[model samples]
Target: MLASLLAGLGLGFSLIVAIGAQNLFVLRQGIRREHVLAVVAVCTLSDLALIALGVSGIGLVLHGVPWLAIVVRVAGALFLIGYGLLAARRALRPAGETLAVTGPATDAASSASSGTLTATRRRAVVGTALALTWLNPHVYLDTVFLLGSVASSQGDGRWWFALGAGVASVVWFAALGYGARLLAPVLATPRAWRVLDAVIAVVMVTLGVVLAVGG
Candidate 1:
């Protein structure tokens, strides 16, 4: 049981450590301070729900439906390409200035930047969450299908492995989104945003190409 738990943890962390669109979006939100809590909550909850669904035996359905993986892969590829293009476009455009804050700090910043922090385009938290959850086929493969299938293969202790995986998801998303605020100042600069946008674009494009090539 202990070995299974540790295995699940290692698997969960390994899959999530990649720099994907979802993580990039969360990092961007943390930098802006806009809807940070919403972003974190949505990400963590979505991950937990998916992990639970996967561990609860739904993963078998994915394996049974052979065409489903192809469809998800195609859809995920397109989404990544689109996101990459958009990020590249944003990188080329004049960067907008806005500050995201919470608690007293936000209120204080709002008062201070009343006229300076103009309204700019931002991704809706729920919309972003859905995109991250559904648009990426790799998510299904990693959490729902692959992880679930592996957990199910663990015989009597399958649930323990699943629980370990689910816990890791909660801990990771929370830490990445909230813990990241500590470096918000560094990420808030226009140069930093530009660099992040570029990196996001590159990562998305690279992933898209790989997926398209049957990865």
Candidate 2:
């Protein structure tokens, strides 16, 4: 049981530690200090649920439906490409205040003062978090199919393995979403933001193209 748990934990980290769209979005939100908690919660919860489904053998069911995979892939590709274009636009034409790194107090005060704006921003952030998590087929492939297959190999220890994987998801997302603020100072400048956005645009578009081509 212990060995299975450890195996699951290790495999979970290995799969999630890659530089992906979901991780990138979480990092950006963390640096911005905008709806970070919500984003982290969404991601963690989504991962846990998917892991559960995978452990219960839903992955096998999904695999049997080839058309479903195709639909998800196409939708994910389109969404990624659209988001990538938006990132490119931001990189090319950044708004001054949007990228400004204000003090904590000022940011809190501003958010507190603008109730409607804050609410709207929160909604947008949550929506994006949901879209990014759910629309990405890689999430299903890695968390569901791969993890599920490995867990099934554990036999009686499969549930323990799933628990470890769930814990790993929580740990990783919490670290990523909260730990990213340490880099806030580095991303203070407009030039830095432009560079970051440019990188994001390239990664997103490339992933989209690869997915579209059935890679």
Candidate 3:
């Protein structure tokens, strides 16, 4: 059981540590002072629900579903391509300096700031999170199928494994959201956004091709 617990922790952490669109959105939102709590809650809740469902025999069912993976892969590919295009668009935009004013600030100081935070748009934050979670078929495979298969292998201890993984989700999302915010000063810069968007584009395209090929 101790070994199983450690295995579960390692698996959970490994899966969650990747820098994907979801993590980027969460990090940007945390820095922007948007609904960080809501974002974290929804992300954690979604993962918990999916992980629990996966552990409860759904994993076996999913494995038996013929061509479902192919369909998901196709859809994921299109989604990633679209997201990559959007990131590329952002990358092509003009760069500028921005202020990291939170809550309220002095007028003189605020005036001295020359740029606007385009990423601070609240709707974009929420929408990006939703897209990263729901549109990415890899998420389903990882949490619902892969994790589920592993947990179910434990027999009665499957529930414990799921619980442990779910707890990890909560901890990870909370930390990623709030923790990234601590670097708001650097992350709020236009150059930083461009770099991030470029990275996102590359990651999305790579994941898309991998999903489409299914290799």
Candidate 4:
């Protein structure tokens, strides 16, 4: 069980820690501190459900439906491209920086609605997070097919393996979502934000273009 648990943990971290669209989005939300909890919840729960499905042998079901992945890939690519363009616009048209400025907001209600990580955009953030997670076929490949195959190979310890992977999910999301505040100081400048968003636009757009072209 220990060996199985370690194997699952190692694999889970290795697979998840890669620079993917989902991770980048999570990191962005973390930095923005907007709907961070909601974003984290959606992502973590989605992973848990997918991992459970995989360990429970839903991979067999997905294996028979190859077109499902293609559909998701196409949809995801379109969404990502649009989203990247939006980010690029934001980067170019810089909003007043919201980095660690220590002062009480003038109006609580206004700040809640207008600030970077405010409640007004909660719905949008969650929706984007879901699309980023579910629309990407790579997510299915990682959580459903790859994890399922490896977990099944663990014999009776597959559940234990799943458990370990689940733990990894929790740890990674918690650290990423909650731990991103550490960058507030460094990201306090509008210049920093421009750079970050510019990079994000490139990554998101590039990935979308590649996926669309079946690369």
What TM-score, over all chains together, does every model reach? 0.57, 0.63, 0.57, 0.61
Model 3 poorest ten-residue lDDT run: 97-106
**Error in Å for residue 175 of model 4:** 0.2
lDDT of 3: 0.66
Evaluated at residue 37, the lDDT of candidate 3 is 81
TM-score winner: 2
Candidate 4 per-residue C-alpha lDDT over 5-114 given as tens digits, one digit per residue, 9 for 90 to 100: 87677656655654457776777778766678899999999999999988787434435666654655566567657756876887889866453333323466877567
Q: What would the TM-score be for candidate 2 when compared with the true structure?
A: 0.63
- Give the Cα error of residue 32 in candidate 2, in Å: 1.2
Q: Which 10 consecutive positions of candidate 4 have the poorest summed lDDT?
A: 97-106
TM-score of 3: 0.57
- lDDT by residue for model 3 (1-215), tens: 76456545645665665546677677766765567887887788888888887777654553577455455446646665666676767777834545434542235464446435433544565676777897899898778866675564455566777877777788889987788657656666777767766765675565556546652
Model 3 spans with C-alpha error above 4 angstroms: 59-124, 183-215
Model 3, residue pairs in steric clash = none
Q: Where in model 2 is the C-alpha error above 4 Å?
A: 58-110, 183-215
Candidate 4: clashing pairs of residues: 34-117
